[model samples]
Target: MDISLWDQLQSMDKPQTTLNNSVDRVSDEAIERYARSKWLRHKVDDYIKDDKFRRKSVEAFHADLQKLSNNDAKSLLHVSNILDNRSLENIGLDSGDYRNLLITYLQSRQDPLSTYRELILYKIHNVLPEEYLGWFKDDLRCSLFLAYLVKDSIFINAYKGREELISVVTDYLRYEIHMFIEEYTQNLPAYKVDYKGVGEHKTVDILYAKSVYLKNRSKEKDLKWLDSSNQHQIDWTYNYLNEEKRSYIILEDIFFPQTKEEKYELIIASLDILSNVEGTDVESLAILKKRKGDTKIISRGNSERIDVIQRMKKAWVQLGTDTKNSKDKLVLNITNKNKEKLVALAKNVNQTPNKFINQAIEDVHREVFKIDG
Candidate 1:
């Protein structure tokens, strides 16, 4: 609902009260007045939780409120929770800037098409698995702002002479928004809570959000909140599994315990959502985020590699392509000293006794792979 006329009026009038005495929040009176409108109620609920529209950003919010005196401003203020103190502080939040933002948000909200567009984009921001956010945020943000600009110029105050131009702007905004949504949040469920009687708050979940997938040249995907399932695996799927469009995938668990379960549920959901896949094939394709100690090893870099091929890469480069700094060893003393392995190597390689013997001595040079300061 485009800030109701009443909401616009209420926004102009700042309630003498504040949110938990910290941020600007909808006052009880305003809540009571607009209680009948479930949409506005939900908007208020979103505002309360929106750290960006947190009480601290109220100064910026207040600028918007100031535009339309106590009544109009109050209504907007009731709905103006667009940012919180943290974002405000981080971005050097000032009432003046927030006032401008209010104008921005309100201008976007004025039209039905733009309002839905903003809401859908907001949903995309929240919906895409957090793992993809860091790589895609700039694209998403720029898409959002550009969409807003197009709407602001072409539709909000549209004129006749620019009909063709408006159509082009409209087409571009539509195409961009569609692409942004498709790239990140596509083929997945909405970022919403269906309320199956579960409540969780991982004050620590945010800490685990930053993630990177190994094995593939793919970029790191930010692991979001701990689902009742695998966030890590969901992240893995986004960066590695999904991109390949692979028919099957195996994900190893990193954060065990709670995250393990969450990762599992998420991968299962993606499997179900991505295709008509079912039964053991679907089940088998997805990696069962296990609790074994080995699962956590994915997060660690080198030092743990033990594959024969991999070992050669790091430990015995001479066996592969790193034979540069080796020294020819001294001749092996074989007159009387008993050597069973040398005898076996000579027989296996089918080389002369002296040649095999010389090779063994050369191997002892222990080729140096790194240079010292």
Candidate 2:
């Protein structure tokens, strides 16, 4: 069985040694050619040959490596080994070019841990070029870094002068948070079919009630772009968790339905009541024009009229029945203060103002236009 170079590199205790062995097997001419490259020679003399600088750099690198998660540490080691094994002919470039290639590779991979390390190096030691800043700007890694900062701001304390960096990157962080909330909510199960015979109605109802409460709370709060502050991030996280919890509860309710059909019927009936109330409003009559159809009135040129008709249609559909056509039509123009009173009445009944007015009209029609069946 042939193991790939990457697997071997991952398993090896001393990856650098393994890479050096591979280099040794290559022709000395290739090695001498690489050694004589002016860019490589100058880099080695300026940085690698300086004992104090070299020692400090190594120490810093190892210290940072220790701070990474296990998987991240392993990935960084593998990438380092790959760079170390690049031959003069394979790389065919100067030291600065090689460095650029390495940085590009790390950023393209969007390896958060590696990018964070590069950020530390560039911002603190000045070993890397300013162009390497792109690593921190990448969307996914930037969110990861923001998460880290939220967890422990001390990690980047060395670059206190660059607070502007957080401001620049936090938009992506907000976008990520939005996406997470949407994804979590959308994936929740909408109905449950498994608890037909079991006594799960109460459990399901409790869960759904809790979910509805949390979802309503989230709706009440502003969910748009937030300021790039630790407090804002923390608030966003709390809201996100509430959204997630709500979704989970909804999923549970869906997977264990109890009298769901009856519940739906009650909901539809309540909505029908609200719709009837809206239909009787003077505003509704004023906005609707006489039409030759079973629905009686058609919306005039007003967009609000059209919207109301659409909502009425939806409510009728939910009621599982159609309304009778009325040939008679009436138009009324009420005072603005009366309309405000109508709105207040609707709110008190947990219905739209238009809906309450329509229901009142229906009540008056029944009393005035009584016809024996």
> Given candidate 2, what's the lDDT at residue 306?
28
Candidate 1 lDDT over residue span 1-373, tens digit each: 4464234443554445544543344444443333223344455556645644432433444343344433222223223333221222212243355445545565444332234234333433332222323332333212222223233232343222223233333333322333333332111211111111221221112111111111111112212222334454345443443344543222222111134443333233233222211221323223212221122222223221112113322433343243443344344466544566667779899987678877765665444534333
For all predicted structures, in order, the TM-scores are 0.22, 0.18
True lDDT of residue 121, candidate 1:
38
Each prediction's Cα lDDT score?
A: 0.34, 0.34
What shift in Å separates residue 28 of candidate 2 from its native position after superposition? 35
Residue 293 of candidate 1: its Cα lDDT? Answer: 14
Return the TM-score for candidate 1, rounded to 2 decimals: 0.22
